[model samples]
Target chain A: MPHITIESGKLTDEQKRTLVERLTAVSSEVMKIPPEFYSITIHEIDDASYGIGGKCIDLVKQEYMEKHS
Target chain B: MPHITIESGKLTDEQKRTLVERLTAVSSEVMKIPPEFYSITIHEIDDASYGIGGKCIDLVKQEYMEKHS
Candidate 1:
C-alpha cells in the first residue's frame, strides 16, 4: 500500500487545505486511487528542529530574506 | 511493505548524506526494520515549485527569517 505523508513547517489553514486537495488530486492521477483513500499528513516542524547537513536550514532562510525581509 | 522517502528542500551534499544515514537509522529504530530494506528519497523542490495551500511556503520563509536574519 502506498500511503503518502507530507511533513512541512508551519502553514496557514488555507495552505494546509490546498495541500490536501492537491496531494489527493496528484495521488489519484498518478496512482489511480480515489482522493478519499489517500492520506496526507502535515507536520509543522519548528525552524530549529529542521536542519540540513547538520546545520540549521540556511537555504530556506536565505530565500525568505530575499522575498520577505 | 513500507518504503519511506524523505522529500526535502535543497540540501547540501553533507545534509543529504546525513539524511540518508539518519532516515535509515530512524526507520530501523521506529519500524524495527533494517536500513537496507527502507527506501529514502530526497527531492530538492525549488522555491517556486513547492507551494503550501495556494501560496508558496511563506511560513517556512518566515521561520528562516527569524533564525538567519
Candidate 2:
C-alpha cells in the first residue's frame, strides 16, 4: 500500500477541497483504486526551500541581475 | 509543480536510500522533470489510522470473530 501526500502552494479552502476531489478522482482513474483507500496529506513549504530545475530561484534572480545590469 | 510525499511501513535505511534514488529516477523518466526539482518527503503512519477499501481493518477482524464464532 502506498500512502500519498501532496504539497502545493498555500491553497485556499476552496482550492484544497477542489484538489482533494480532483486528486481522488484522477488517482482512481489512473490507478484503478478506490478513493477511500488512499491516504493523502498536504503540506506547504516556505518559498525559499523549493526550487526548479536545480536552480535556487533567488540565486537565479541574482544571476539575471548581474548579467543584465 | 507538485511536491510528493511517500509513506511506507517502517523502512530500513537501505530501503530509504533506495527509494529516494528510484523515486527520483522514475519521476524523471515519467515526468521529464529533473530529479533535483522534485521535493520528496517520507512518513510512516501507525497501522490503526490506515485502512483499505472502506473497511477499517480492525473492524474487519472483529467481524471475522463474530462470524466464525
Q: Return the top candidate by TM-score.
A: 2
Ten residues in sequence with the least summed lDDT for candidate 2 chain A:
A23-32
Give the clashing residue pairs of candidate 1, or none.
A15-B53, A53-B15
Model 2 C-alpha lDDT per residue in residues B1-69, reported as the tens digit of each score: 457787654566766666566655554444455767667777765446656577665677678999999
**For model 2, how does the per-residue alpha-carbon lDDT over A1-69 read when each residue is reduced to its tens digit?**
457676544556765665566545544444455767666676765445657678655677678999999
Interface RMSD, per-candidate values to 1 decimal: 13.7, 7.2
- List model 1 lDDT by residue over B1-69, tens digit each: 124444444567776666456545643554444656555566666656666556555566777899998
For model 2, the stretches where C-alpha displacement exceeds 4 angstroms are: A6-69, B58-69
Error of 2 at B11 (Å): 1.9
How close to the true structure is residue A14 of candidate 2, measured as C-alpha lDDT?
62
TM-score of chain B of each: 0.70, 0.66
Task: Assess every candidate by TM-score.
Answer: 0.43, 0.45
Provide the lDDT at A57 for model 1. Answer: 56
